[model samples]
Target: MNINLNINNKIYNLQVDVDEPLLKTLRTLGFKSVKSACETSNCGLCTVLIDDLPHLSCTILSVQCESKKIVTLEGLSEEVKIIGDFIAEEGADQCGFCSSGFIVNVISLKRLYPDIRDELFIKNYLSGNLCRCTGYEGQMRAVRKYLEV
Candidate 1:
């Protein structure tokens, strides 16, 4: 199928397979940040923003995103850096395999709830994104630090 998708504020013309996951489509288009640890949406490593909300790219079909706006980690570099600085300072960023998805979700969290300051609420908001290394405490601390700024 041939479709036009608005990704990272740019239009892309792509010919994709009917059953191809958006994760693969995006990687094919050089959006390497959209990685996949589990294609079943459990890992959240393939997360991307669909109309400003986090969605597992591995579970979404390329054709389904034809008319929607998609934002990958590449599109939100500055926001990523804003949060990443805290994550790094807090020592939450480890291995870096899940950084893209984790950062994307963090950005979404802030956008979705601008006034969020509760630690529990922040934890629950990012429950879907799993990182094997830091065990979440560092990430949580990083988020708290970011929110304070």
Candidate 2:
């Protein structure tokens, strides 16, 4: 089966099974930055920006994402560098498992809420992602600094 997808501002013709998860299809298509953790939607490791919003690729079907602009962490190299530098400065890259997903979400949040002003709001929004290492403090700090707060 051949399907057309717009990933990271590029068009791709993916030949994959219809039941394959978007995550698998993406990785097969060379989008390795889209991490695969929990196959279910529980983990945000497979998070991708769909239409500028964070969408878990593990939960979305490849066919359903035919026309959406899919932006993975690899696509956000500049933004990730900014966030990664902050994380390294704060010694936040412990396991490095959740960094990609967290960064994607932070980018999306900043784009959506340019003038956000609430600590609790930040905490609540990032709560969906889990990190066994580095804890949440470093992630929070990275977000705060990125948002210039």
For 27-76, candidate 2 gives per-residue lDDT tens digits of 88878878899888887888899999999999989999888898998899
Each model's RMSD to truth, in Å? 0.9, 1.2
TM-score of 1: 0.97
Clashing residue pairs in candidate 1, if any? none
Which candidate comes out best when scored by lDDT? 1
Residue 93 of model 2, lDDT score: 85
lDDT of 2 at 83: 79
Total backbone collisions for each predicted model: 0, 0
**Candidate 1 segments whose C-alpha is farther than 4 A from its true place:** none
lDDT of 1 by residue, 47-99 (tens): 99999999999998999999999999999988888899998898888799988
| TM-score of every prediction relative to native | 0.97, 0.95
